[model samples]
Target: MRLSQPRVHPLTNDLTPEQAEVLAPLGQGGVIPAGPVLNIFRTLAHAPQALKAFLTWGNYILSKKNDLPAREREIVILRTGFLCRSGYEWTQHVEIGLRCGLTPDEIQMLKAGPDAGWSPADAALVRATDELHADQFISNETWTQLLTHFSQKQAMDVVFTAGQYTQVSMILNTFGVQLDPGQTLDPDLRVG
Candidate 1:
């Protein structure tokens, strides 16, 4: 974790009318959603307009609209989250990754990166993510490898997914977002 406490605390249950209006769309019957609202959403509610815009892009990335399949997208997301050391992003995505068909071993391999005994196709995705993280551009070799298993649109989505999660990791880290209740931080996700 980057900070001892949240830089921006979660929203209180009592909200002003304007604040309620801003957050209404995220909930049902004009009431805040039940259960523990994610700290990310709660913190972001402070800037309702920006949060609204963010949800649009976030939905696209998480939705079937992205050319990558759910599992493949999760690969990019989990790897990006690991590389960026965003515990919040990683923990949240772990559950999503499982639902997307990533096994426990596969999830563990993500921490070992592109060379962690993955199939060529899966490895290529992780390699591309690493290249983008390290150089902000994929090398010709990785591009060629990616072309073997992905359509041009799917290949582009690999980059987009990684980029999106990288940005998300930055937000979660910089904002000092904490894990929600019952969500434990991964032992490996240590900040320097």
Candidate 2:
């Protein structure tokens, strides 16, 4: 966590009428779930329009409509969150990544990065994410390597997922969104 307390605390209840409407998708009868997503939603509800816009694109990225497979997309997401050192993002995505078929061992290996002996395709995904983080763009070499395994659309989704999570990571870190209950922060992600 970048800050000891939230710069904008999660709104737990007593949402205004407009806030309730904008946050309706998160729960039934205006009650959001208790978790990191809820914290994020409540904080973002401070700007309902922006939150609405965020959910629209975010849904597409996480949905089957995305060109990348769920597991592959999770790889990019976890890698990006790790690179960004966003504890909340990392903690939340670890659960989602597991559901998407990532092993605990593989999630740890992601912190080891592209050279961690992943298959060629998985390595390419990590390399692409690293390149985008370090250079804000993928290299031609990584791009070519990715094409060998991914459809062009999948390759594009790799970038899309990376960019989106990078943004999420930034928000979670900068906003001091603490870890959700029951989440253990990776020791590697702990800031001094």
Candidate 3:
């Protein structure tokens, strides 16, 4: 998608030719696709140890058998994506959220709030995310409801999942990250 804002850091133009080439393949287009944004991530990729650890943690969040269901995991992710206005995360995960069984309407409603026509379980998940992100704690009522649908272990897992995604959303948004060319924005998003 075309960028609507100037990149916060323009990496592609600033990189040494060799460093740019080394980091290009990890992004779309099989080369370090030229653009204003994405230079920040490309630069970070130069630190292979840090990059590998970060990607591994991201992989574990999605692949592990955490207490929350895949659907719940996706819900928190989508809500956090919209809240943070992370174009990259929102673009990529909206499709993943749908494939994981969130209806288009349900996903859109998350922009409004977690309680808009959501089931008790679903609303609780969204509330938990908001509380954690906003207040760094979930209230007892929401916690009790979350436990109704998730085991204790899953409850702990939810905190980590939301925390990880929140960090992702912040990094992506603050860096002015853009979706790679040919990627569409998530449907029905209402950004400020």
Better of 2 and 3 by lDDT: 2
Q: What is the total number of backbone clashes in candidate 3?
A: 3
Off by over 4 Å in 2: 27-37
| lDDT, candidate 3, 107-179, per-residue tens | 7888888769898888888888888878889899989988998888888878988888888877666656666
lDDT values, one for every candidate: 0.86, 0.87, 0.72
Each candidate's clash count: 0, 0, 3
Estimate, for each residue in 1-192, the C-alpha lDDT of model 2 and write its tens digit.
666689988877778888888887674421223334467778889888888899888888888889999899999999999999988888878888998899999999999999998999999999999999999999999999999999999999998899999999888888888776667887888887
Where does model 3 exceed 4 Å of error? 1-43, 186-192
Error of 3 at 53 (Å): 1.4
TM-score of each: 0.91, 0.93, 0.76
Query: On residues 1-192, what C-alpha lDDT tens digit does candidate 1 reach at each position?
Result: 666578888787877676566666553421123555578887888887778788788878888889999999999999999999899999988988997899999999999989999999999999999999999999999999999999989999998898889888888888899998888889899676
Candidate number achieving the greatest lDDT relative to the actual structure: 2
Question: What lDDT, from 0 to 1, does candidate 1 have?
Answer: 0.86
